[model samples]
Target: METQLRKGAHAVFNIQFHIIFVTKYRKSVINEAILSKLREVFSRVCEKRKCELVEFNGEDDHVHLLVDAHPDNNISQLISFLKSASSRIIRKEFEIYLKQFYWKKEDPSFWTDAYCIVSTGGAPLEVVKEYIKAQQKPKM
Candidate 1:
């Protein structure tokens, strides 16, 4: 994975996150064509947020993303946008195929409301803890 720092006007940072999105009711609705479309949609969303979609892949019921994000971004908003936009686009593009999985014809949802997001990169937690512990104590 690339660990290069990104520069903003007044900040230099390297923040990455691993995110997971599951289909509504964990339905196995994703096929090769859907996966391809997902990758395209996710890439565009990441770019729109000024983030890099470092890695993206999925199985039938779920998808995973590794995003290198800017500090200025609000992760929650980014995720909301990702889910909503992707869901709308996917449902529109593959309505006929998705119908079997999602029976409700009106406003069918693609992804579940819940998601998993974890910060990544830099040293391990224990290593960081030890480094902090080793710092010189302030004079009494």
Candidate 2:
């Protein structure tokens, strides 16, 4: 989701949140359909959450998203929302195998608890876009 640039804002700030989050091994396996759906769901979440998903990239293990959000939204809240919602969507939609830690009758874990974040302070949009585009898959 791309944010509309309205002119003459009292405080027009472009806040970018670079999210580096991953799924557990053998869970949310890397597949074309899964990846595509993940991106789609993520975009929709941003749209509903009033955020702009500027850029995204990933391999099988991890994903990188560049999000430009408004000041009223809290960083941790958005991160938690994105990670938890996407994880649930993936597991239920794909019926992927779940590790014991992620297995449950009520809810499952699609993403690991660990996550990385980089808040861009007054950085240009292009700069953030380039970094997200250039995010490489973690070597393991």
Q: Which numbered prediction scores highest in lDDT against the true structure?
A: 1
RMSD, candidate 1, Å: 1.8
The ten-residue window of minimal lDDT in model 2 covers 1-10
Candidate 1 accuracy as TM-score: 0.92
Query: Could you list the CA RMSD of all candidates, in the order they appear?
Result: 1.8, 11.4
Q: Write the per-residue lDDT of candidate 2 for residues 38-138, one digit (tens) a residue.
A: 78888888887778788987887788899878766788888888888888887777774444336565657677788899876554679879989999989
Candidate 1 backbone overlaps, count = 0
TM-score against truth, every candidate: 0.92, 0.71
In the range 61-128, model 1's lDDT, one tens digit per residue, is 99999999989899999999899989999999999888888978775689999999999988898998
Error of 1 at 40 (Å): 0.6
- Cα shift from native, residue 105, model 2 (Å): 4.8
